[model samples]
Target: MINEVILDDFSLKVTSFEQGVSTSSSGTEAKTIRFDFEVRGGTEYHDVTVHLYKNTFDVKVPELDLSFRGTINNYSTSRTDFTNENSSSLFRLELIEIG
Candidate 1:
C-alpha cells in the first residue's frame, strides 16, 4: 500500500491514498492525488494545517514514483481545534497537478 507523501517540507504518513486523472471543461486532463492522514498531537495538527493553507506545493508520492506542482482541490478535517493534550485529527486532502 502507498503510505507516504512529501508535501513541500513535511513528510506525512498516509492512512489511505488514491490517484487519478481529472478532465476539465476544455477537454484538458490533469493528475489528481488524494490521501487521508492523521496527526496525533495538538502541535502537529497545528503545523499540518498551516502547511495546507499555502497556495501550492511540490508534492511527491514515492511509492508511485510521482511528483508534481499541486494545489489543494479539496481539504477537510475531523475537528476545528486541537488545543487539548493527546488530541488527534483525521485530515483528507485532494491535490491536483498544475505543473
Candidate 2:
C-alpha cells in the first residue's frame, strides 16, 4: 500500500495514495498524484497549509522511486476549524505535473 508522501519539506504519512495520468485537450498526458492524510489541531493545520498553498512543490514517493515537480491541482479538508487540541480531519491533496 502507498503509505507516505513527501511534498516539499513536509513528510506526510498518508492513509491512501494514488498515481494517475490525465490527457489534456492537446492529447498530451500528464502525471497526477493524489493522497489522503489527516491533520490534527489548529497549529498543525496551519503549519501544513501555510507554505504549501499556491506554491509548486517537489513531490516524491520514496517507496515507488517516483518524483516530480508539481502544483496543487486540488486540496480539501474535512474541517475548517481546528482550534481544539483534539480536533482532527482528513485532508486530500492532488498534485498535477508541471509539464
Candidate 3:
C-alpha cells in the first residue's frame, strides 16, 4: 500500500497503487509507479488534468521514502460503474532519480 503520494501542490487520495522496476533489452532499468483515483461529487476533472502532462511534475511517496522528478508515460480513465456517474482515472508515472 502507498501511504501517501504528493504531487506538486496537491495530495491525492489513491484507491489503488502499484510500483515496480523494469529493464530494457539494453539492460537499462527504469522505475515506474501507477495509481488509481476516483473523481466524484465535488471534484473537477480539469483540476486533475492541469497537474498532469508529459514531463511537468514532481512526485514523492512517503512510505517508500522515494522522491523523483518524473513524467506521465501513460494514462487512462474509465467509469467505475456504468449504472452510476462515478469515474476513475489511472495514471502511470515513470521516475528518474535525481542526484
Q: Give me the candidate number with maximum lDDT.
A: 1
| Candidate 2: segments with Cα more than 4 A from true spot | none
User: Candidate 3 — number of clashing residue pairs?
Assistant: 0
Pairs of residues at least 3 apart in sequence or in different chains that clash in candidate 2: none
Return the candidate ranking by lDDT, descending.
1, 2, 3
The local distance difference test score of model 3 is 0.63
Model 1's alpha-carbon lDDT is: 0.88
* Predictions in order: lDDT: 0.88, 0.88, 0.63
Off by over 4 Å in 3: 41-43, 79-99
RMSD of each: 1.1, 1.1, 4.1
TM-score of 3: 0.69
lDDT of 2 by residue, 5-87 (tens): 88887889999988999888999988999899999987888888886774688889999999999888998999988888689
Which candidate gets the maximum TM-score versus the true structure?
1
**How well is each residue in 1-99 modelled by candidate 3, as lDDT tens digits?**
774677766677777888877676777876677777765422445566566653545788888887776566667766433233364444444444322
Relative to the true structure, candidate 3 has a C-alpha RMSD (angstroms) of 4.1
Using alpha carbons, what is the TM-score of model 1? 0.93
Better of 1 and 3 by TM-score: 1
Which candidate, 1 or 2, has the higher lDDT? 1
lDDT of 1 by residue, 11-74 (tens): 9999999999999998899999999999866778778878777858999999988999999999
Please give the lDDT score at residue 91 for candidate 2.
92
Residue 15 displacement in candidate 3 (angstroms): 0.7
